[model samples]
Target: MKSLIQIFLVSALLTTCINVNAMTASPQSWWVGMQTNSLQIMLHKQNVAKHQWQLMPYSGVNLHNIIKTDNPNYAFLNLEISPSAKPGTLVFNSAAGGRFEYSLNARKANSSKRRGFDSSDTLYLINPDRFANGDSTNDSVKGMLEAANPIERGGRHGGDIQGVIDALPYLQKLGVTQLWLTPPLENNMPSYSYHGYAITDFYKIDSRMGSNALYRELAAKAKQHGIGLVMDLVLNHFGSEHVWMKDKPTADWINFNGDFANGKHATSHARQTIQDPHASDFDKRQFSDGWFVATMPDLNQRQPLLANYLIQNAIWWIEYADLSGIRVDTYSYSDKAFLANWTKAIMTEYPQFNIVGEEWTSNPAIASYWQAGKVNNDGYTSSLPSVMDFSLQESLIQALNEDESWNTGWVKVYQSIANDFLYPNPDNLLVFADNHDMSRVYTQLKQDLAKTKMAMTLLLTTRGIAQMYYGTEVLLDNTGSNDHGDIRIDFPGGFKGQKSNAFTGQGLTIDQRDMLQTISTLLNFRKQSAALSQGKLTHFSPKDGVYSYARTSEKQTVLVFLNKHAEMKSWPLHYMEEVLGSQIHATELFTQQTVNLNKAVTLPAMSAVVLVIE
Candidate 1:
């Protein structure tokens, strides 16, 4: 017993001495620390005697001045972890008698899954202020323009980023793959800038909408749920009340500061002169320097410092938010040279990033000039990857509104696309039936549900990225006028005490639910269909009121027919025989019914059919 007690005492003393020596010998030169709501870290020490790692308690370890320590230590690190650690780990070696080594292994505590956006995404474009207002706390900000009034169409209704973040599941159920909120940058104009066009600060998110950190969290949360966030950016102008405007950075900080040039009427013929080498500088300045409104001052991209600042601001947002894509507003108004450089820099950092520019020209030639890869007559180069298909929107509107005529009427869309040769790559174009600037698609089609469905079918099956304006699923309308304020009315259920709520699908007429379901089904179907994305497009326009197209890929083929005849008509097989290529089987995508392509398929008046060839 005495001998055993002596051995135990000696062993304890040796262990204590060794531990003290190990801690003192190589006073840790480096340490790791982490603090994030989204992740956590765990530390483990290697036990060579046990031939395994033993978990170390680093919950409250201090990591300041880590690099000032003496010994070198190796540690394994994990990212996007969870379960929370107060500090982290530090490891060192003992050199009391002989050299001893210690190392650390950092394993992720809990990791969330990763997701990516894809081509089948049905983008929902929302002006957040007009969407929903879940929180009324931040309605009135300090020192900002405009008061929050839910009843007023043009006033800030307190619809914020948090509101949208709260409604993600509602959108997810509606089969929305992406969300495109309008510009949320601070717009500090005294009044009527609630739409966020007049940016006061590029770096700060509009306080009414949310904080920068909140926006980043929104993006991270949206990504976790398999949703893509598209940021709306503006490079053309800043709010006249912008702080920099009060104290100009340089003589050329703003374009034509000596005399403010009011905006000129957008004429494609006149604007196309921008690409002409012989065009007078007066004409160029008129287009580039002119202000969109008295309250919005055109920015001078020619100023090198301002240009760099704008470019860096865009990159900073992308990096900070890990954004899926960008939508540049007023794409053509900026300097052509500056746009090329800006786009090149963004594309360099994010190779797969997507961007859609708003050219807002109905003429394909004028619009195509701004799209990337268009070889201009004057050797003008552009780096823009995509453009909003304004031509398609114009054609769709005219088709729905015009009376049937010999060479006009619904055939306008067929002819419009026939001139698609103007575009170098039409597939990259963003096709939308309506946006914030235009009359709602439902109103344009005279509130005809069938026609609205037909229009949406065309947009979804067409050979370009499709974007749906918010409230299209529920057939939201602007009543009659196309005034800006009237066009961006408040969304149902966006505010407290609202009689209707789009999020809950309450107070909606049966017709509204039917339209919403139609959109939901088609969008979900589109999520799985590659033909709508990667397929080759072949279209035919044989008559004034009839149009058809086929999208074929390696695995599938889809046929779409649009008939705007006042009466039902049977479409002959020969019209689409070239694309059918001896079709074996066909099924309607919307109705899920087998279709007989060999027989003349009768279509209802002003109706469309999307048939999937099996």
Candidate 2:
């Protein structure tokens, strides 16, 4: 409504008052010598698109194009950095007086050749908010919508990255080679943000948890102790509190026109739609583009700009934090084409890096479809390296809880592993007894210590990469409730007012101490066994209440027996002659005593027997 002269003067004043540091830039920094020569920087400021951007004279660096979106506050600078470019500050000046300096830093030596987690590693999943609280000062961070409320089940409990850093020694001693923490990114929701699934900011860590620098520090410290870090990422949806929910970059930045009807736009969770040949377009849309919950807005990755942003963000975290792996939450919920491009970009950058997606289906056919090397009828090629073995997890729990029958008990486990042929690389799958989203294995087995032992032993000695919930070693239980907060209980001695200390083995119940020893023994042994980690598996059909298998490497062979009987059973060796290979003697892993393999081996009731034949 103002006159031309008045508006001109106001615009001039705003440009003169512009603070380059105050304006935000996605990938605020960059590095030279990346695998890709193309880089896109999204600049966000008041009327940022109004000014034409120019790059100061720098060798081998050129501003190829500037993309101005529908939003006047956003500008995308497409840059091409040739190999001749050196590491330095890039000065970007606007037509007016506004200027911004972006760093083009040097990459770490051989950064692209970094190795990721594999079958040799044991992943321990920790819900950081419930793990430990090393710094109480940031318990109630200012400006965060939800404050610390330890008494409330769903409220934040103040566990920060520093706590994880402090526990590296303990975790290293426990023989876990990899740590998979739930999303530690910013989740500025009104409540129940402690679980860290609904991320508000993709680039920054939650202030209540810790700063981005502290997260990098934890990764470095973990690496020093022969441990790797696996970051959990949510790609399908984000917290509604994210800035895109208000000032969107594009008209279709969020799916379904950014509208969340009361349970109307919710996802059908029909994961099979992605592979079902008979799926209708309506069903596919309902499963893929629909919102997860009212508080979470599904992202429209089909938009090329947003797709580039997400792909770049993931690579940025890997480079910035030196992460060893990534675990994608709700893997199949995003646009399949975008997921393919996203993973292909990452794997192209770091060919050896590992990424495991959470398909969360008991059907091996559906879960295996997402893994790399899968040949699908629809010609959908995935670059994902691994998928969680939910089939084995569900089968293991049911096997222990059910009575021995022709189709029950040990047969369930045998049948579960029998389905491994469906996987392109079964050894790459992640096997776990329980995770943050479900009841603890101890509770699922009705607090039967023997069955828990059997389950842990089988997981540790079986095929695929093994992951255990944080407090599984201590038998953390949430028997009566299916609440998420209860499933992800705080570790013993992590917070104040805890009677038992799992770290120090003080004041723990005898059963807890025993279970801890069982887990520690298996983990330590597995660390040295090439046979157990990545090996050829041979199994016999389930006979009576026993299921047996052998994992054989070039140098060592590991024999495992899971007996669900009520009394000790003598398992014959003739059934496994091909796997045993005329070995006369073997050492029991638990007792460390040599036994003659010419006859039958004794397996205790409701227990596992793991032996090494070298």
Candidate 3:
């Protein structure tokens, strides 16, 4: 009888341990004083809905309700945390005798008022997997689907948060004020996961990249170097292998009943349909509801529970990581209504925070509709503060590669910038020469060093936030193909057996060294130039292959001239008299030569000239 009793007790204890271990929460914890009082926590486990839950009495905390879904594995708890609630733990018990603890932590001082990246900041976009490998031990973590294969372009290269932390001083010296790393969230896909678009777990960082604590440490160390961190977030879709895919909370958790139908439900990429007044309902649905690929399942943000989960998840990360900004990938592919709510919630909590959305369109009309304060004719409003300047990006490429003409060349760039009026706040736009999705600027310019210099000069001197792809300063190029893997090539000296070291400036050709120096000079100068950072822009029409513009402010005036001629030209400055006023002499930014602005300025062949008048 005693032996049988011991066996029964051991079985009961094993069952209890399994139950406790299986239980999980989306946001495992909360803060004491947020802007909002109500919080919804999603709990997941085996047969979680079958058990009745009761919260242990805690001061100023009330269990408003428990919502059970169609699936027995999921339960949602709606709680009201009052302002007077203090930081403590709340214990909950189920009728089946299962218990779990949730924590309510105190908020950091002035957490909600943290400043975000702005036009004055230059963002350096890094592919963490290709930047450097500081912790090779975590490179091929056990149980991870993919391992480090540095030789394979598409395979993981083992770069982690520590690598970025190691290179903070190099980035600071490179004149980068902000670092925009590609989505470092967990991507457990079998292949092609290095890009980080297909996120499997939203709350957890990829072990191959680093832990959540290490990510926060990167943010802290970056701050010490005067660089803010910008997290790249994917809201449109997630990896098909996400846990929710196997056990959905709601029937509509994944779009199309979680069925791809073998490309039958692929997105039409009709982004303009969002703003098109006459777009068909079928087209709108196909564009917004369709999946990017079979491996990437489109999320149904219309589901209230999922919506709440995503919003709270974003807020939780912002608080946890002390982030400075967020870059939303494939911004318009998500449900339009949910997008409005999502952006509004984030902005409400952090009024000074900035979020840039990638609309990926050259038409400012469509992109402008998503910016906050846009007065849409269809009565739609967005809380998005910034949009990528794709029009200028395309036009700048054309302006550099094509010959000057009445309807071509520099005119394209001029017309592109002229459309800035459509934007509510043009200065908030993100200007970049090349991003990870496209060919490097040097390759696009056909390895023309002079033209590449002109492109960088215009991007940095323009009236917007600037972002440079990693290794652009060293003229990293993909000459043969535009493969994404090639575009995101590994940085020199980040891994073993590389002859060049960008950090130490070893094995770099003369041209590479010059390009690095030129970009460094322009970026550092931009940091100190009020006229370039946030000022009024007055531009002259393309004349004799020269595109001239002047950025003026209360402190000083900056004149920029992009001369495409093969020989030095004396460009007349009479057209800029209104902005120049009584200033006669100016200092050249690059050569530091004093120039007389009374008549004309001498511009170098196929080069950019920036002159400052005080």
Candidate 4:
């Protein structure tokens, strides 16, 4: 081990080097909201903690406190801004350094009143690096650690915010009301910068992706087209290469002793065990404190300062970009109490906004525990409004692929929905057939066009916010491999001179075109149907290779039938009196053909049929 004199000498050298440079402050811009009174500005400079900071007497802003840390490179300045403070720059000076100015801007009109995505919205998830390269010039931005490489699956492909802007029209026409892009923040990693999950600079967008202004522009443009933007955020950990790794402000800024190579600090992937009543302290610590990956250093939210920093970081993004929602990655991996507080803080600010946590579990019991209003035995409460419906996704695949049985196939789909009692509000769940990390839904059903369409139909008509992975409409599949790099294939038309263009519908197979049309029909119809958006669901038990469900709103009712039988089969309607009571007529939503509800409804073999009560 190094001696005390050696450690002090090293620290002194760093402190001296940073001292020669000017002081830096975070949150270059601040929005003064109704409840956003005090703002914490973190100052970064060598030996910054050694000097006291004071704010000049200003009209509407006052110095609350200056919080210094163990590291000499950082200090926190808490400034309370009164309502009278107009949009201008607030200056703070330190005897140790010079002036640090932070601009305050008036929030946009009706910002707090902005609505988050819900069941009424269809989320279209896209990987930016694989979407499209709008500007080739930005493909290889100078100084960025990574270079653009289309042939490299895990490398950056130059897809930026401008590419997303160009696709807004296409996405809107496809009937998606919300666009969820993977993280666009700066990830200056040596490799795998395309993923954007390993955030190096939270305040700035990845240079390769575009500037922060462009990201805000994407949100603005999307909003103009009646589309909301959902930003993917990570609260569990950040890229290990983050600048903080060089000069940490506090000893516990990161978990695992700030060392991922340590075998003792490796993650145990024991998330569900967090809710176990008999779980040991060791197991609980391992789940919450371990590093996410060697390149990602787990954060210690138990530290109140770090917790507030993260909470403010999320709020900063929402306010900066006018975001409609946030999808938290690896929700259950962070400290449980910190997660609770984080959600509460966001909800308190944006009561109408929505935040969906990525709890990738096949068990409804565990996923439900993360939703708001869950009365856990351990007294755990979550302010999270929505969670990804991994259970339903898995069940949908099984329901279509496996044969019907007592506890398998169609029964799997039925029983999963029956577990809705576990969630505080099942309609708020984000349901999807597959996402970036999973095998494409088309591949999951063995590339059977009929099964793929049926799955899409079910998800569109089901009782939650439906999300479709990019290229799913065109049957993008990776065969049977679970490799994430392959699972997220580039959209056929994203690049120039591609084999086929999804945007222009060029060079596509008959099967692909048919699947695309099938999904387009269902999504467009669902967009106009309140019954499929915000409605009550009633499903019956599977019977004779047939499963049925209904979504009914005030005056609109939608009935979905899934038939796996070999030949055309008709199911009696007399038992469906609750939904079809006294209704003698129905309209086939897909074909727009009228039919009699009093007689048995005929279902095609291995197909999904939708009808509206008339």
lDDT values for all models: 0.71, 0.90, 0.90, 0.85
List the lowest-lDDT window of 10 residues for candidate 3.
8-17
What's the lDDT for residue 25 in model 2? 79
Off by over 4 Å in 4: 1-22
lDDT of 3 by residue, 463-485 (tens): 88999999999999899987888
Clashes of each: 5, 0, 0, 0
TM-score list, all predictions: 0.79, 0.96, 0.96, 0.95
What tens-digit string does per-residue lDDT give for candidate 2 at 354-425?
Answer: 999999899999999999999999999999999999999999999889988889887888899999999999
TM-score of 2: 0.96
TM-score quality measure for candidate 3:
0.96
Candidate 1 regions with alpha-carbon error over 4 angstroms: 1-119, 258-270, 542-544
